[model samples]
Target: MSVTGGRVPDHHPAHHRARGRRGGLSPVPYVATTTRILRQLAGDHRSVAMIVVVPSAIIALMFFMFQDAPRRPGVPSPFDDACLIMLGVFPLVVMFLITSITMQRERASGTLERILTTPLRRLDLLAAYGTAFSIAAAAQATLACVVSFWLLGLDTAGSPALVFVIAIINAVLGVGLGLLCSAFARTEFQAVQFMPLVIVPQLLLCGIIVPRDVLPGWLQWISDVLPASYALEALREVGAHPEMTATAVRDVAVVVGFAVLAMGLAAATLRRRTP
Candidate 1:
């Protein structure tokens, strides 16, 4: 407030303080948002099923598909090799779908607008979303990895714990990317549509189906930049090495960098308008 004019100018300290209050973080709002999101997700049985059941089902299906395939003595089963990476990829895809659609629904239904009217800063809201979904992602990855390693006989030459950790990170990466992409979608259907555009290309180029070195020069360059490529590379490293190597560490770092970048972009793009 200005003493003389009865209006605070842009240069006024009071104006700056008020702005900081509106934009600053508050633990109360952050915890409330996280709990509210978790409660809502719990009530949505289909989303719960997607998070808990879908990834394991996919892994099971893949296991059966390769159950009887021939392999030379002392050789790793092709399924084991694929399953290591798929464990990460499956949760990632599922979390991406769930996160993007859920955010789109919130935007289209005016929930975001109501939330923004509160004391919740945009960054706090996004951080809460990240925390909530990352929990879901961790559960999703754990279940799938358990089913793969125990029930399906999926083998890894490396530490299974490391594989599990990477799987969770991959799922978190999906959540971040999903949040970023949801900002551009006005409808759930459009959010779904982004999966093919954003995820499918990375799938084809992520060195799962073909060796990345065998890919064309352009494709190799493209793969080098996709987060999924780094994720797969890390998983393959865990599958082939009994211990974590520098390459795996580097790849995981790259994936984490991309995830953080996506979260930052998502926060920047958040809006109070109902879509």
Candidate 2:
């Protein structure tokens, strides 16, 4: 309980007290909630290091590992391909775990219930979470791209900015997926469990490990339906040819559409305890 001037009151999550006005889908609460998450993230040095710094460091290592490595005349460079895909994949990994686990914690602690008592709608809360994480995802994507292209000598055919944009969109896609997954998890551990189930398949089938063309026709069909495939495809196009082709545009659109769909599913998962 927080000690006020005279009366003792139950403590609330920082997000509940965040800069929200009591009304329908108000921006005040949304911004306040987003700021609240940023504040928590900043304070947690370990998390900041994990989310912001570690991905860049890993990408740098990939650069150094292959900057001068020998390759066959006609063989594909798995190392370089991995690095480009990592720029799109790491943000997804980080955001999915954070959003899923954070939502589970909120539900466990009654934070969601309390927030529902106020004027906040489920859509507003989901948007705040998605917006906040997408901002963080953008930073993560930008850092990975900078290190990969600038320090790591990641050769690319596409413009660095275009690849970076594609990476950011994919990361936001992760945020949406995480939020939807969180609704089914009753604990943080359960949330983490979904990582392998939800994320690993994409890594394996998204044309990152094996080009979809070479995969069995059935597997290629599966990859076509996954959002990660489009993201990886878009990144590869820019890194390989650096063109704004129709294929790249379609993939980008598909990824963004899924992100919106995920957020809508997340909104439906809200606890209807009060309203």
Best by TM-score: 1
Candidate 1 lDDT over residue span 1-275, tens digit each:
55775776798876765686674577898999999999999999999998999778988988888889999888889799778878878867888899999998998988999998876888899889989998888888778878988888888889778988898888888989899899998789999999999999999999888989999999999999999999998998898899899999999999999999999999999876544
What would the TM-score be for candidate 1 when compared with the true structure? 0.92
| lDDT top scorer | 1
Model 2, range 62-83, lDDT digits (tens) per residue?
7677767788875546566878
CA RMSD (A), model 2:
7.6
Clashing pairs in 2: 19-32, 20-29, 157-242, 158-242
Model 1: residues >4 Å from true position, as ranges?
1-24
TM-score of each: 0.92, 0.86
Q: Candidate 2: global Cα-lDDT?
A: 0.82
Candidates' C-alpha lDDT: 0.87, 0.82
